[model samples]
Target chain A: MSQVPPEADLATQDLPSDERAMLERLRAGDAAAFEQLVRDHGGRMLSVTRRFLGSEEDAQDAVQEAFLSAFKALDRFEGQSRLGTWLHRIAVNAALMKLRTRKSRPAEHSGDELLPKFLDDGHQATPASEWRDGGLAALEKAETKELVRRSIDALPESYRIVLLLRDIEERDTDETAKLLGMTSNAVKTRLHRARQALRALLDPHLRGGL
Target chain B: MLSCRELVEFLMDYCDGELPPEQREYFEKHLACCPPCVAYMKTYQQAICLGKSACKDEEQKPPKMPEELVRAIMAARQAK
Candidate 1:
């Protein structure tokens, strides 16, 4: 989750000297500075987009667009936060814009099937089983990491985006709501449900039953 | 004691520490005796931790940036 604070302290004067110099160079239209910016941040930006957009091609396009957008807005950057932080927000928005424009992938899971079921008496239909402590550490393995990513990608678009914004990107509820054009309540509900569904999807693997 | 269904329903609030004191007390009272709900809460928390760690791993071992992407963005910036 993003440890970047919800409110970035916009005291440009407090920016580190190196970042300040980079901002100045960017604002001065130094070609090398712009290229350097891309080289420095592009990989991380692409990673952010790749999660939002599972397609490599789309992720590349979104990162490309994000860099261009950032370049165009260079004058507006107040140096309040680290340049990387600003770029992260821009990258996320670019990916979301791409998500809005594209058609949904075939065979996406609506995530409803994975949600926990309850009986008429307000009890779990199936009692929850405990996975051994530290069982989830399997996610560090290459195959398990892929499984985790695939599980996230399997979620429905709306819920997936909410999950990405809230959990992965660590955007606040109000900001995520604004970004998705939904109410905070809606974001919270979707985030909670998304977590539940994702938990169900990973249960077998976590339980070593996969 | 809160039923398992009600506990699950407000699970997010409880975990987030957003539930009011009374409701949270009831929620905990239920968890104190219900082994299943305790397991459910632990797994649910672990799921969130796994998701964040999985994504954060990308930063530790970032995917290779395609050279073409760098070229394209630079070209676009030059055009602008």
Candidate 2:
């Protein structure tokens, strides 16, 4: 006899009644339901697109594209994931597409500058200093928040995008890889390098803030 | 003992708790004798935490999605 994992069995069940009803309404071309869906998920979707696209015009365009893509693809939605999760993925893909189509500028290539330096013997060239006692609590200050935001923005585009997808969006390696059209190993390598660079960038301020 | 350079390379895996058991043991043993690596690891983790916190603030106060954008999206869909 085959033994189904409990979680897998749960996944195969229908989405909750309200969500199911909403899906049906959407399928039936209910305009109000569609409006509700956009209003409900639009803000987060916009935020995500803005981070990836940077330009206000591009972000708005990406959000519009994402919602439209989601609407057209409603019939393909499976019950395995929440509608919001599914929508989020579409939004990320929409942003990526916009990024692809954008006019190419010279690659910034700043990742090496921001990455930690090591001695020939494989030790950090610069010793790390202890940060101030506050840790994340210091983010309460708007100034500190802005500093962190700017540091992240300073990373090279490729590394920044990976950092945003992996660290900020909280996407898993496989999903991130699939979205970025990279291998899982490539995703991990980029993620690691991004973190190391970010750490180096933040060190001076975080350390002095103490 | 893992060299500080090797430890730096493994920082992500060690922090993610993805390091194999034997490797993790070696990583920690190095940390025990290495103040600089410990400090590096701490700040590395703090950088991630600060980033997530800062970004969460941005999401919590998302830039308002223009109403016109919504109308535009609906219009585009209808036109299609």
Q: Top TM-score: which candidate number?
A: 1
Which stretches of candidate 2 lie above 4 Å from their native place?
A1-24
* Residues B1-80, model 1: lDDT tens digits: 78999999999999999999999999999999988899899999988887888888877777777898899998988887
In model 1, which runs have C-alpha deviations exceeding 4 angstroms? A1-13, A104-107, A139-142
TM-score of each: 0.89, 0.84
lDDT (Cα) of model 2: 0.83
> What is the C-alpha interface RMSD of model 2?
1.8
Model 2: chain A TM-score against the true structure: 0.81
| Alpha-carbon RMSD to native, per candidate | 3.5, 5.1
Instruction: List the global CA lDDT of all models.
Output: 0.84, 0.83
**lDDT tens digits by residue: candidate 2, A1-210:** 101101233331379888888989999999999988888888888988877877779889988888887887777676667787777777877888888888886767768887778899877788877788646767888988888888887888888899999999898899789878899999999999999888888888888783
TM-score of chain B of 1: 0.88
